[model samples]
Target chain A: MALVRVISSDGAAFLVSQRLAKRSGKLKTEIETFRKSSDNSEAQPEIRIVTIRAEILRLVLQWLQQHQNDPVLPANQNEQDGRGDAEMGQSQWDRDFLAPMDLGIVMELILAANHLEVKGLLDITCKLVESKITGRTVDEIRTAFKLKSDFKGNEEEQTRLENRWCVEN
Target chain B: MDLNGTSKEVEEEVSQHYVSPPVTPEIAPTPPPPHLSGETCWDNLPPEVQEMVVEKLGDKPKLLRYRLVSSSWKKTVDMILERQFLSVWTEWEPFEQYPYKMNMHDYYDYICGYDELEDDDRNPTTGVILARAIIAGVPRLRPIWSHFAEHDRKANLIPSFDHHLPAVHNPKLGSPIPSNCLRIRFNDKIWPEIKRFERSRRAKTLADFVVKYDHCFSYLRALLLTDIEISPSNLATILGKLTNLRALTLEDTLLHVEPETQEENAVLPLHSNLSHLRIISTNSSASQLILKAYHEQVISLETNCWVPLFSKPYGNLKRLKLITNLKPDAQFRQGEENPFPALKYLSIIIHEGHVFEWDELSRTIDACPRTLINLYLDIEPRWETEEDKIRQLAMSQVTIPNVKTLGIFLPTIPQHAECLRRLILPKFPSVQQINLISGSWGCRSAIHGKSENETEVYDREEVIRRLNAAKIVAKNVERMVLELQFYATVCPKLEYIVII
Candidate 1:
């Protein structure tokens, strides 16, 4: 079996099968380009993800290994429909996988999933983050995200005043 | 974060817009790996990821409250607002329960009074200004038109807004047009409420209301006028005024006959912005009336009606969707001038009243332009199966070689497999993909197999029994090879036999 070594930002290395690594669109492109550009025919490709640190990179790999056989969803698939493919693809395993993660870590997973071009992971992670924001009040949202009100003194009142304009109401 | 060699090579690898920049102090490659437990870094997800989260938060009130979370969120939320807030589908219905009861004249005047949107704090990103006074669209029309609104995804976009209107709508009803366009629908049920409210409050006719919200309607890209009994002159005036409308759906709309206004057959002036026109469920008279009004400017037509265009085809018709029985009209015949010269996609949806007439169906297929790349033939045979119809439909030939994606949606009945083998697959000699979307249960099971093991979705023996019964063999089709519990193998030319 063909093998590819995936390295994370903190310099941790994980060896996965070429078939499994190809599930990540980012890895697939990198491997294909490596095969074409390298002088040796039998060289195993090594890809280093600079943005995603070791922990988040491992999480994304675990997801890819679980869903390796799943059909590659075209990245624009979710954008084609308004309701999105998030709810339909999310399994019990996915839920349990995400249940114990902190909001901050989940936010990091959203970034890693996004950069890796794994549409399903990106959608599920974004949906998990969306659940944190959907029905919560503004202050609760601030608490959930750990964000302080950076709005300047008068801007908060202006944001409050402008909030009354044309929405569904 | 490594700024040395790996990051630059990675930049060339990823999409240009998605390239992670070398870590600066403010925008470090990421927030130091969530390991820095006390660091305030969740909001530091790139703007694109933030926007995706906002889109998942697909409602108005939540999206609005999302702004108050922090300065970063407000900026990211505003970006989504700027892109999606191009149009506000305001149907000036009564929302007395809404605490901010502003008048229509006041709202329109204020927005128009300010001219253009500025880069100020007051831009309501997803704010669909619900009209307090009766102005935009009438109430009965609300059910049909709400599907076009972006906030209709959750249906619970607002708790207090429009609650008084009866909930005879699906919250997740898909929007037909793009989210950045305005939709205006008028119906009869609105007048009584409007009349009562008009006498006591802001009373105005449809014409007056259109004039009042002229600035709002400037964002109007698609207008659906259905079952309107308004005066002909009034209809002409309203149609004439909406110059920015890109698509118009006329469904028994131009029925009014007031001779005092103009001649009985007076042509309505054509606006240049009109390119795609749809005539829905039009009878002979209605079809004629629509063509007489605005047939010259139409370049694309999707209609169930098929009478008026027989003699003079719109020479530039690029996309056409015909809904009718399988029997082809006399004009759609072989060895004739290509009526739709520029047609790229042809969709024929066979209504329920179809008969077993393969010769006519074949002739209709022959009339399709060679340049056509997509063909969708949907024969919705619900409940009962007519074996004779299936056989005849199978005999119907599809000869468009350029057709890359052919979608055939029929019942999941067993006989249709024979039709696919003998008739459908052979004709599309060099087609790329075939989306067989008929077997609802069996197909769903097959698609689920792509993600999870779903051999039980359809009993395996039952599917094999049906396949064997249909006499589906490799020799029958050019390259057809059916796997148990799934679809056939896709050859090099035929890339995907996506049975879903």
Candidate 2:
């Protein structure tokens, strides 16, 4: 099998099978561009993804390798119904894959998956972040995400007034 | 923690991947993951990713909590709220216990004072206000209109408020109006409106209310209007304003007059944007409107009345369900217009009718011979003598070439097994599913209002034998659903038989 070298931001190089590397749309398009630009058909292409760190890139590759056989997620998933990850083809493996990651790692993975155009990884990671915020109260969420409440009394009142129908509880 | 330093350093390094710096730096300020466990906080995610997380929190209450989390989080929630804003008017009706309470039209008797308005009277105003208050703190305008407050109820005393005239108003949480998809339980001829006037505007007509809330109606998507009392013209006017509406449900709506009474058919304006139109009106006006105005665009229609449009050419109509009394007044015109060329799903329930005519139903199915996919026929066939005629009709006349799913609820007799095998089973060449719903036993006995000892044959074996006999004719039928009310013995006759 032909191999593709994927380089992370920290200069860590990982050689992955071309089939698994093609799971990332960005890499696939870049490989296609490289194939066209260079006449040498035998040389293995090396692509650098600078936005993703070495650790996060490793996780992304793990996900890509696992889901390489799965169908590609539709690009306009967000524009569809607001129902959660199930509609986006999230699976048990995906839930288990995200369960062990830290919140920071999950967030970083979301940015990395988005940059690499790995939709399944992006959807599952975003769902993980959403599951954190879904049922928790404002204080619980603030504590969970380590957020500082910035709105003052009057501005808070203004915000409350705008969302009158949904804030009954 | 040193973890924050590492995450921040990595975040800054990641930012270098972008060709240029973002215009607003604070919006992209890479906050160190602030959780005390030395983990990275979700504070530094981009606004787009933040929006995705909020959108994933589908329920309203959780989105509300996220809004209350912080100003930036609130902004993310607000962006979602803007697009998915739902406005609902629940036309509150008193339970069976309070039937004599003030109705939408006759509210004058109940309103003896300002507080004398019945529960239904306060539903639209308080409901919308409370619903909005659930979202916003205090909406600027309180547009409350009680249809029965002026005419049906008598206001003998002034209203009372907890806050005195001189107090700095510390209002509770709620908005009087929601800007998005409002699932309002609408009743009465009153249109939806909320105003800032000192006294309530009880006399304002629905026209005035619509004019006031025209902008709100413009953005409306899904509207569920229940127990609406309006003239056909008013309904047309209301539907006209909802230009972007996708789904409209009118339940138990009473038209001012029957459509047949009009000197000429009402030249109603078409709502081309409407895709799903469901009307539960006893009168045929709603169905008439679908036929006349929205024949070109409506995809799904569920109405109590069947119109002449079924006999006419309708290429776009996919799903049609009729739950009306099969009175002889149904106008099934034998027109040259090709009917239901694209119809895929059809469900017809004839109430309290014994005689099942072939021409009325056969023509429609015959029209869409190649297109009809799912057919559900719920009709009470006159028990004994009509069975022969039905069998002959099914055998000779009915031929739905492309029907995939077929459900027939008929009064069956043990002797009519041959009738089912010969007439019914062989008609559909493409039927992959067949459901035979037996009303009561093998035949109607004294238990089912027929004379006693009509044939105590409630045998599943007999039906299975007949179905096996019929299976020879339909080789393509993959599954068969048998819904028998009573049966003597259960048998696993066929691999595909699902007995219910």
Candidate 3:
């Protein structure tokens, strides 16, 4: 099994199985291009290092490792199914793993997942974040996340109005 | 040594004097009381980190609070807030009651930017493309022109003398124009081309046009016109003409009685190509009328408050969902008459009061048991009488042995969890996953501390115990999801329980 070196944004390096890394379309494409270049001897040695930040890359690799062999879903299948049986089955695990993490960390993971093109992880993380805000009031949400209120005067009122509309009929 | 000590002391005193009394504030000016107002925290974070923070907040209202931190932060927060709003609107289903309101200009902008619309640039307006496919028509530029002219007219709220200019040159003009001359002129300009195509004698041309723009019907897949009162004849005509429709969703559209003709008994033509059908209505008569012509070609059938006469079963249906007000007596009597046999996935939304009679329906389900692999039941409890509720609770125990996945909602009661444990565990042997959503204080109190009312509270250990007990009782269960909604603190176990 060929191992691929992944360098995170924070300069941390971890070796991941090439097969597992290929689960991410972005990494797969980069690897393919590197392999093509190496075949032509157009680049330096073939030690390909996929550089993504340590924090974000770690989550992506963990997810890919967990779901490496899962079947690629059909394009026309309902988008909801992208969450998949595996993730839905372990939704509580995913939820618990996310609960204690800083919102910033979760957001970083989401972006990283998006960048890596990890559909399952992206969907689950997005859903996790979406769940927190779906039925919550702006004030209550601010309190929970320790966010400072930025809106003032009319803009604030408009936001409240929009939120009320969202929550109510 | 004694003489040197005096000299050393003098040297020490001189060094202390040179040290300036440890830099003591000369006037001891009370350091301007640490200014607390202009403190910066999140602002000091790198822009990327700040963005990450904002994104983590996602659609939560907390992002709004970030604006109060500083002016620069406010701008970034506002931009993100707007993006989040638009993202939610685009991704999630539009609110049923107040569908996102857009004016003509906004609608035009949305259409222009719509990715699908870009794919068919030949048809400037998606609406005209759809209209062309609906009623065989010529695509004219006049509709777009008229729309803009009308918008300009409306914005100005003034009469335009040049509105009639489009009427003369445009090929889409209609005859017998209305008294609103400008509007009529514009309308006339647009209708002639459409009318010409409609009046075309060439069947091949019509068929070719239908195929060319058939994919335009995908736009109609988003329509939620439930309140529209549609005549059955009109519906039949419209639906019959929509040969390319893949999905048809009708929610509470009032059905008008069709006038009987000599061919009243004639069999209605079915749309064999329709792949998905979703019909939700409170009116049973309307439901029957809609189902009467249901083509067996559908792969997915979703109906709420409706039951079909299963005269011709669709063997290809993979998903069948029926949400109805259940009557125990009716269900029990209907045993042995399993309506949907080919359904691999089934979801039932049953009233809590009717749960007691679910066992009666199990006989019917048992007849075609093996095919159903997924079952979701939303049991809504009736909070009328305790004794009656207990009887219904007991009824929830009747299980479908073959169901692989089961979701149940229990009423909030002191013994609700225990009741569900007894009712559900034994009956569903093949069940791999169970989702149990509990209602307020009665169930939630078990995990979180008791409310001031001293209601039955559920502790985390208690919830875990109940789950373990339920799992033990269930023969083949692999995972359980316990969700408790409380008046006070939510159940801690819910946070840890893995949902399968």
lDDT string, candidate 3, B1-500, tens digits: 12122354434432322111112222222222121111223344445445544555533334544443434545555445334333321332211111233221211111111112223543545333211100001112121121222222222101221221122211111111110000001122223343322212122232232234333222122222333344455455445545544555566555544454332333334766566666766355555665666645666766665443344556667676665665423442344545556667766655334543435444434443456766655554333356455555544334465666555654334344444454544555666545444422234334333442322334434555564454432432222323222211222112222121
Q: What are the lDDT figures for the candidates, one per model?
A: 0.54, 0.52, 0.43
Q: Judged by DockQ cut-offs, is candidate 2 incorrect, acceptable, medium or high?
A: acceptable
* B120-209 per-residue lDDT for model 2 (tens digits): 435654432211111232112122232333334432122111110112322231221233344333333343442212122221244344
Stretch of 10 with least lDDT, candidate 3 chain B: B176-185
List model 1 lDDT by residue over B1-500, tens digit each: 12121345433532321111122222223345444342336666788888888867865455656666766776666556534432222121111112133222212111111112223412335433232222121111111111112433332213322232212321221111122133333332323332322221111245554554454344456665543445545556566667677666665443545444464664565777677776765556556655665555566677777855655556666667776654553656533676666777777766555643455555656666787788766544332257675555534444777878776653244454555545556667666766555432334434343432222223434434443444433243322234322233222366555444
Error of 3 at A68 (Å): 15
For model 2, what is the error of residue B140's alpha carbon versus the real structure, in angstroms, after optimal superposition?
24
Give residue B212's lDDT in candidate 2 (0 to 100): 52
Docking class of 1: incorrect
Winner by lDDT between candidate 3 and candidate 1: 1
Please identify which of the two predictions, 2 or 3, would achieve the higher TM-score against the true structure.
Answer: 2
Q: What is each candidate's DockQ, to 2 decimals?
A: 0.15, 0.25, 0.03
